[model samples]
Target: MYGVDACPNTEEPPDLPALGTLLVDTSRNNRVGEFRGGAGCYWSLRPMGGGTEWEVEPRHVRLALPIEQLRARTARANARSRGDIL
Candidate 1:
Protein backbone atom coordinates (compact mmCIF):
# COMPACT_ATOMS: atom_id res chain seq x y z
CA MET A 1 0.00 0.00 0.00
CA TYR A 2 1.27 3.44 -0.91
CA GLY A 3 -0.61 5.55 1.61
CA VAL A 4 -2.62 3.26 3.87
CA ASP A 5 -5.22 3.96 6.55
CA ALA A 6 -7.68 2.16 8.79
CA CYS A 7 -11.47 2.14 8.85
CA PRO A 8 -13.17 1.24 12.08
CA ASN A 9 -16.49 -0.46 11.40
CA THR A 10 -18.47 2.01 13.50
CA GLU A 11 -16.59 5.23 12.79
CA GLU A 12 -15.02 7.21 9.95
CA PRO A 13 -11.90 6.24 7.97
CA PRO A 14 -8.45 7.03 9.40
CA ASP A 15 -5.09 8.25 8.17
CA LEU A 16 -2.15 6.00 7.26
CA PRO A 17 0.49 4.59 9.56
CA ALA A 18 3.99 5.92 9.79
CA LEU A 19 7.13 3.88 8.97
CA GLY A 20 7.65 0.53 10.69
CA THR A 21 4.29 0.31 12.37
CA LEU A 22 1.50 -2.28 12.28
CA LEU A 23 -1.72 -0.46 11.44
CA VAL A 24 -4.28 -3.23 11.66
CA ASP A 25 -5.61 -4.99 14.68
CA THR A 26 -5.51 -8.79 14.38
CA SER A 27 -8.79 -8.92 16.22
CA ARG A 28 -10.81 -7.16 13.50
CA ASN A 29 -12.19 -8.93 10.48
CA ASN A 30 -12.49 -5.94 8.13
CA ARG A 31 -10.76 -2.62 7.45
CA VAL A 32 -9.91 0.04 4.85
CA GLY A 33 -6.90 1.01 2.77
CA GLU A 34 -6.02 4.51 1.59
CA PHE A 35 -3.68 5.42 -1.25
CA ARG A 36 -1.63 8.57 -1.50
CA GLY A 37 -2.54 9.53 -5.07
CA GLY A 38 -6.02 8.06 -5.31
CA ALA A 39 -9.31 9.92 -5.07
CA GLY A 40 -10.19 8.10 -1.84
CA CYS A 41 -9.53 4.99 0.26
CA TYR A 42 -10.72 1.41 -0.33
CA TRP A 43 -12.51 -1.21 1.78
CA SER A 44 -11.24 -4.67 2.69
CA LEU A 45 -13.11 -7.27 4.68
CA ARG A 46 -12.35 -10.89 5.41
CA PRO A 47 -13.72 -13.85 7.30
CA MET A 48 -12.75 -13.77 10.92
CA GLY A 49 -9.52 -15.54 11.86
CA GLY A 50 -7.35 -18.50 10.86
CA GLY A 51 -8.29 -18.98 7.21
CA THR A 52 -6.13 -16.82 4.96
CA GLU A 53 -4.19 -13.65 5.56
CA TRP A 54 -3.27 -11.01 3.02
CA GLU A 55 0.26 -9.67 3.11
CA VAL A 56 0.59 -5.93 3.41
CA GLU A 57 2.94 -3.98 1.20
CA PRO A 58 6.24 -3.24 2.88
CA ARG A 59 7.17 -0.08 1.06
CA HIS A 60 5.45 3.16 0.11
CA VAL A 61 6.18 5.82 -2.45
CA ARG A 62 7.98 8.85 -1.10
CA LEU A 63 8.57 12.04 -3.03
CA ALA A 64 11.75 14.03 -3.13
CA LEU A 65 11.54 17.78 -2.73
CA PRO A 66 14.30 20.35 -2.58
CA ILE A 67 14.80 21.70 0.92
CA GLU A 68 14.53 25.26 -0.31
CA GLN A 69 11.27 24.55 -2.10
CA LEU A 70 9.78 22.81 0.93
CA ARG A 71 10.77 25.66 3.19
CA ALA A 72 9.37 28.18 0.73
CA ARG A 73 6.04 26.39 0.56
CA THR A 74 5.74 26.11 4.33
CA ALA A 75 6.65 29.76 4.76
CA ARG A 76 4.08 30.79 2.18
CA ALA A 77 1.34 28.78 3.80
CA ASN A 78 2.17 30.05 7.27
CA ALA A 79 2.24 33.61 6.07
CA ARG A 80 -1.06 33.18 4.26
CA SER A 81 -2.62 31.78 7.42
CA ARG A 82 -1.51 34.88 9.31
CA GLY A 83 -2.74 37.21 6.55
CA ASP A 84 0.73 38.28 5.59
CA ILE A 85 2.48 38.00 2.22
CA LEU A 86 6.03 38.96 1.49
Candidate 2:
Protein backbone atom coordinates (compact mmCIF):
# COMPACT_ATOMS: atom_id res chain seq x y z
CA MET A 1 0.00 0.00 0.00
CA TYR A 2 3.05 2.34 -0.01
CA GLY A 3 2.53 2.96 -3.72
CA VAL A 4 5.41 0.57 -4.37
CA ASP A 5 4.04 -2.58 -5.93
CA ALA A 6 4.09 -5.39 -3.40
CA CYS A 7 3.91 -9.10 -4.00
CA PRO A 8 0.52 -10.77 -4.13
CA ASN A 9 -0.08 -11.11 -0.39
CA THR A 10 -0.93 -14.55 0.82
CA GLU A 11 -4.29 -15.56 2.33
CA GLU A 12 -4.59 -12.40 4.42
CA PRO A 13 -2.22 -11.76 7.25
CA PRO A 14 -3.62 -12.61 10.66
CA ASP A 15 -5.08 -9.96 12.89
CA LEU A 16 -1.86 -8.34 14.05
CA PRO A 17 -1.14 -5.82 16.75
CA ALA A 18 -0.84 -2.14 15.89
CA LEU A 19 2.60 -0.66 15.27
CA GLY A 20 4.74 0.40 18.27
CA THR A 21 2.90 -1.99 20.59
CA LEU A 22 4.82 -4.07 23.09
CA LEU A 23 4.30 -7.80 22.83
CA VAL A 24 5.97 -10.98 23.88
CA ASP A 25 6.24 -14.27 22.13
CA THR A 26 4.01 -16.31 24.40
CA SER A 27 4.87 -19.46 22.47
CA ARG A 28 8.56 -18.82 22.93
CA ASN A 29 10.66 -17.80 25.93
CA ASN A 30 8.73 -14.60 26.58
CA ARG A 31 10.67 -12.52 24.09
CA VAL A 32 9.59 -8.87 24.39
CA GLY A 33 9.39 -6.61 21.36
CA GLU A 34 7.68 -3.55 19.92
CA PHE A 35 5.50 -4.45 16.97
CA ARG A 36 6.79 -2.78 13.83
CA GLY A 37 4.88 -4.25 10.96
CA GLY A 38 4.43 -7.42 8.89
CA ALA A 39 6.35 -9.31 6.25
CA GLY A 40 4.35 -12.00 4.57
CA CYS A 41 3.17 -14.35 7.34
CA TYR A 42 5.56 -12.92 9.92
CA TRP A 43 5.52 -9.60 11.79
CA SER A 44 8.54 -7.44 12.56
CA LEU A 45 9.33 -6.19 16.04
CA ARG A 46 12.20 -4.42 17.68
CA PRO A 47 13.55 -5.14 21.12
CA MET A 48 12.46 -2.92 23.97
CA GLY A 49 15.72 -1.01 24.27
CA GLY A 50 16.09 -0.89 20.51
CA GLY A 51 18.44 -3.46 19.10
CA THR A 52 18.15 -5.82 16.20
CA GLU A 53 14.66 -6.46 14.87
CA TRP A 54 12.99 -9.85 14.75
CA GLU A 55 10.13 -11.56 13.05
CA VAL A 56 7.31 -13.50 14.65
CA GLU A 57 4.12 -15.25 13.74
CA PRO A 58 0.99 -13.48 14.92
CA ARG A 59 -0.09 -16.55 16.89
CA HIS A 60 3.07 -16.35 18.98
CA VAL A 61 2.65 -12.82 20.24
CA ARG A 62 0.38 -11.22 22.81
CA LEU A 63 0.21 -7.74 24.29
CA ALA A 64 2.65 -7.21 27.10
CA LEU A 65 1.07 -7.11 30.53
CA PRO A 66 1.36 -3.99 32.65
CA ILE A 67 4.01 -5.49 34.86
CA GLU A 68 5.94 -6.72 31.86
CA GLN A 69 5.75 -3.32 30.28
CA LEU A 70 6.99 -1.64 33.43
CA ARG A 71 9.85 -4.07 33.78
CA ALA A 72 10.90 -3.65 30.19
CA ARG A 73 10.79 0.10 30.36
CA THR A 74 12.65 0.05 33.66
CA ALA A 75 15.29 -2.23 32.28
CA ARG A 76 15.74 0.00 29.30
CA ALA A 77 15.98 3.03 31.49
CA ASN A 78 18.55 1.33 33.67
CA ALA A 79 20.52 0.37 30.64
CA ARG A 80 20.43 3.94 29.41
CA SER A 81 21.58 5.19 32.80
CA ARG A 82 24.41 2.72 32.68
CA GLY A 83 25.21 3.93 29.14
CA ASP A 84 24.68 0.46 27.78
CA ILE A 85 22.40 2.00 25.21
CA LEU A 86 22.67 5.37 23.54
Candidate 3:
Protein backbone atom coordinates (compact mmCIF):
# COMPACT_ATOMS: atom_id res chain seq x y z
CA MET A 1 0.00 0.00 0.00
CA TYR A 2 1.22 3.49 -0.80
CA GLY A 3 1.70 5.87 2.11
CA VAL A 4 -0.33 9.11 2.20
CA ASP A 5 2.71 11.16 1.22
CA ALA A 6 3.44 8.86 -1.69
CA CYS A 7 -0.04 9.03 -3.15
CA PRO A 8 -0.18 11.11 -6.35
CA ASN A 9 -3.76 12.19 -5.73
CA THR A 10 -3.25 13.24 -2.13
CA GLU A 11 -2.92 16.92 -2.91
CA GLU A 12 -5.22 18.97 -0.70
CA PRO A 13 -8.25 20.67 -2.16
CA PRO A 14 -8.33 24.46 -2.08
CA ASP A 15 -10.06 25.99 0.92
CA LEU A 16 -13.67 26.90 0.21
CA PRO A 17 -15.07 30.36 0.82
CA ALA A 18 -17.85 30.69 3.36
CA LEU A 19 -21.39 30.64 2.03
CA GLY A 20 -22.61 34.12 0.98
CA THR A 21 -19.05 35.33 0.73
CA LEU A 22 -18.35 37.56 -2.25
CA LEU A 23 -15.79 36.36 -4.76
CA VAL A 24 -14.57 37.30 -8.20
CA ASP A 25 -14.51 34.66 -10.93
CA THR A 26 -11.40 35.59 -12.81
CA SER A 27 -12.12 33.05 -15.50
CA ARG A 28 -15.45 34.74 -16.13
CA ASN A 29 -14.17 38.22 -16.86
CA ASN A 30 -13.84 38.96 -13.13
CA ARG A 31 -17.54 38.55 -12.59
CA VAL A 32 -18.52 39.15 -8.99
CA GLY A 33 -20.89 36.79 -7.22
CA GLU A 34 -21.80 35.29 -3.89
CA PHE A 35 -20.51 31.89 -2.92
CA ARG A 36 -23.34 29.37 -2.93
CA GLY A 37 -21.43 26.13 -2.35
CA GLY A 38 -19.30 23.49 -4.02
CA ALA A 39 -19.65 20.06 -5.56
CA GLY A 40 -16.97 17.73 -6.79
CA CYS A 41 -14.25 20.19 -7.86
CA TYR A 42 -16.45 23.09 -8.93
CA TRP A 43 -17.84 25.94 -6.87
CA SER A 44 -21.31 27.48 -7.31
CA LEU A 45 -21.70 31.26 -7.43
CA ARG A 46 -24.85 33.36 -7.66
CA PRO A 47 -24.98 36.74 -9.29
CA MET A 48 -25.25 39.73 -6.99
CA GLY A 49 -28.66 40.78 -8.29
CA GLY A 50 -29.81 37.18 -7.97
CA GLY A 51 -30.01 35.23 -11.17
CA THR A 52 -28.81 31.90 -12.48
CA GLU A 53 -25.84 30.36 -10.69
CA TRP A 54 -22.68 29.28 -12.43
CA GLU A 55 -19.97 26.76 -11.66
CA VAL A 56 -16.29 27.59 -11.71
CA GLU A 57 -13.02 25.90 -10.86
CA PRO A 58 -11.61 27.02 -7.52
CA ARG A 59 -8.33 27.92 -9.13
CA HIS A 60 -10.13 30.62 -11.14
CA VAL A 61 -11.76 32.26 -8.14
CA ARG A 62 -10.39 34.87 -5.84
CA LEU A 63 -11.64 37.08 -3.02
CA ALA A 64 -13.25 40.20 -4.44
CA LEU A 65 -11.35 43.40 -3.95
CA PRO A 66 -12.91 46.03 -1.68
CA ILE A 67 -13.92 48.15 -4.64
CA GLU A 68 -15.38 45.18 -6.45
CA GLN A 69 -17.36 44.19 -3.34
CA LEU A 70 -18.73 47.70 -3.01
CA ARG A 71 -19.63 47.80 -6.68
CA ALA A 72 -21.47 44.47 -6.52
CA ARG A 73 -23.39 45.48 -3.41
CA THR A 74 -24.34 48.78 -4.97
CA ALA A 75 -25.55 47.04 -8.11
CA ARG A 76 -27.61 44.63 -6.06
CA ALA A 77 -29.15 47.46 -4.13
CA ASN A 78 -30.01 49.21 -7.37
CA ALA A 79 -31.64 46.07 -8.70
CA ARG A 80 -33.63 45.72 -5.52
CA SER A 81 -34.80 49.30 -5.81
CA ARG A 82 -35.83 48.65 -9.37
CA GLY A 83 -37.66 45.50 -8.28
CA ASP A 84 -35.38 43.34 -10.34
CA ILE A 85 -34.75 41.12 -7.35
CA LEU A 86 -36.54 40.47 -4.14
Candidate 4:
Protein backbone atom coordinates (compact mmCIF):
# COMPACT_ATOMS: atom_id res chain seq x y z
CA MET A 1 0.00 0.00 0.00
CA TYR A 2 2.82 2.39 -0.79
CA GLY A 3 1.82 5.71 -2.32
CA VAL A 4 3.26 9.06 -3.44
CA ASP A 5 3.12 10.70 -0.02
CA ALA A 6 3.95 7.54 1.88
CA CYS A 7 7.62 8.43 1.43
CA PRO A 8 7.74 11.99 2.61
CA ASN A 9 11.52 12.49 2.60
CA THR A 10 11.78 11.55 -1.09
CA GLU A 11 8.61 13.25 -2.35
CA GLU A 12 7.19 16.66 -1.62
CA PRO A 13 4.41 16.77 0.97
CA PRO A 14 2.06 18.28 -1.60
CA ASP A 15 2.56 15.31 -3.88
CA LEU A 16 1.28 12.80 -1.32
CA PRO A 17 -1.95 11.28 -2.48
CA ALA A 18 -5.14 11.50 -0.49
CA LEU A 19 -4.68 9.43 2.69
CA GLY A 20 -6.54 6.15 2.81
CA THR A 21 -7.68 3.44 5.22
CA LEU A 22 -6.53 -0.19 5.24
CA LEU A 23 -8.75 -2.99 6.46
CA VAL A 24 -7.72 -6.49 7.44
CA ASP A 25 -9.84 -9.57 7.93
CA THR A 26 -8.38 -11.69 10.76
CA SER A 27 -7.97 -14.87 8.75
CA ARG A 28 -5.45 -13.58 6.20
CA ASN A 29 -2.92 -11.23 7.72
CA ASN A 30 -0.62 -11.78 4.77
CA ARG A 31 -2.82 -9.66 2.46
CA VAL A 32 -3.37 -5.87 2.65
CA GLY A 33 -5.42 -3.11 1.04
CA GLU A 34 -6.05 0.66 1.11
CA PHE A 35 -8.74 3.30 1.29
CA ARG A 36 -8.97 7.07 0.78
CA GLY A 37 -10.05 9.89 3.13
CA GLY A 38 -10.80 9.58 6.84
CA ALA A 39 -9.19 6.75 8.81
CA GLY A 40 -6.31 6.06 6.44
CA CYS A 41 -5.65 2.57 7.78
CA TYR A 42 -7.99 0.37 9.79
CA TRP A 43 -7.87 -3.20 10.99
CA SER A 44 -10.16 -5.57 12.82
CA LEU A 45 -8.46 -7.35 15.68
CA ARG A 46 -9.66 -10.63 17.23
CA PRO A 47 -12.77 -11.25 15.14
CA MET A 48 -13.89 -14.48 16.73
CA GLY A 49 -16.78 -13.38 18.92
CA GLY A 50 -16.42 -9.62 18.42
CA GLY A 51 -14.11 -7.56 16.25
CA THR A 52 -12.19 -4.59 17.58
CA GLU A 53 -11.53 -1.79 15.11
CA TRP A 54 -8.07 -0.29 14.96
CA GLU A 55 -6.94 2.58 12.78
CA VAL A 56 -3.34 3.13 11.82
CA GLU A 57 -2.20 6.59 12.70
CA PRO A 58 -0.72 8.54 9.81
CA ARG A 59 1.93 10.23 11.95
CA HIS A 60 3.21 6.94 13.37
CA VAL A 61 3.35 4.93 10.15
CA ARG A 62 6.84 4.21 8.91
CA LEU A 63 9.11 1.86 6.94
CA ALA A 64 11.49 1.33 9.81
CA LEU A 65 13.53 -1.76 10.46
CA PRO A 66 15.33 -2.85 13.57
CA ILE A 67 19.13 -2.53 13.64
CA GLU A 68 19.47 -6.26 13.31
CA GLN A 69 17.14 -6.36 10.32
CA LEU A 70 18.17 -3.07 8.73
CA ARG A 71 20.55 -4.48 6.18
CA ALA A 72 18.05 -6.88 4.67
CA ARG A 73 15.18 -4.40 4.47
CA THR A 74 17.42 -1.67 3.05
CA ALA A 75 18.70 -3.95 0.34
CA ARG A 76 15.16 -4.94 -0.43
CA ALA A 77 13.99 -1.33 -0.58
CA ASN A 78 16.86 -0.36 -2.82
CA ALA A 79 16.04 -3.19 -5.14
CA ARG A 80 12.42 -2.20 -5.09
CA SER A 81 13.28 1.38 -6.02
CA ARG A 82 15.01 0.13 -9.13
CA GLY A 83 11.80 -1.49 -10.29
CA ASP A 84 8.08 -1.62 -9.45
CA ILE A 85 8.71 -4.73 -7.41
CA LEU A 86 7.73 -3.20 -4.07
Instruction: Indicate the residue-level lDDT of 4 in model 3.
Output: 48
**Local accuracy by lDDT, each model:** 0.34, 0.79, 0.88, 0.34
lDDT of 3 by residue, 10-51 (tens): 456689889999999999999999999987667899999879
Tens-digit lDDT string for candidate 1 (1-86): 34364422334435544433223323343222222222234323221211233433322222223553354456546766777633
**Candidate 1 stretches greater than 4 Å from native:** 1-65
Q: List the residue pairs that clash in candidate 4.
A: 20-35, 20-40, 21-35, 21-40, 22-41
- Write candidate 4's Cα lDDT for 8-48 as tens digits: 34432222233332323233432222323332233222221
Give the poorly placed runs of model 4, Cα more than 4 Å off: 1-19, 36-80
Which candidate, 2 or 4, has the higher TM-score? Answer: 2
Backbone clash total for model 2 is: 0
Using all chains and alpha carbons, the TM-scores for the candidates as numbered come to 0.23, 0.75, 0.84, 0.21
lDDT of 1 at 37: 24
Query: Best candidate per TM-score, number?
Result: 3
Error of 3 at 78 (Å): 0.3
By lDDT, who's the top model here? 3
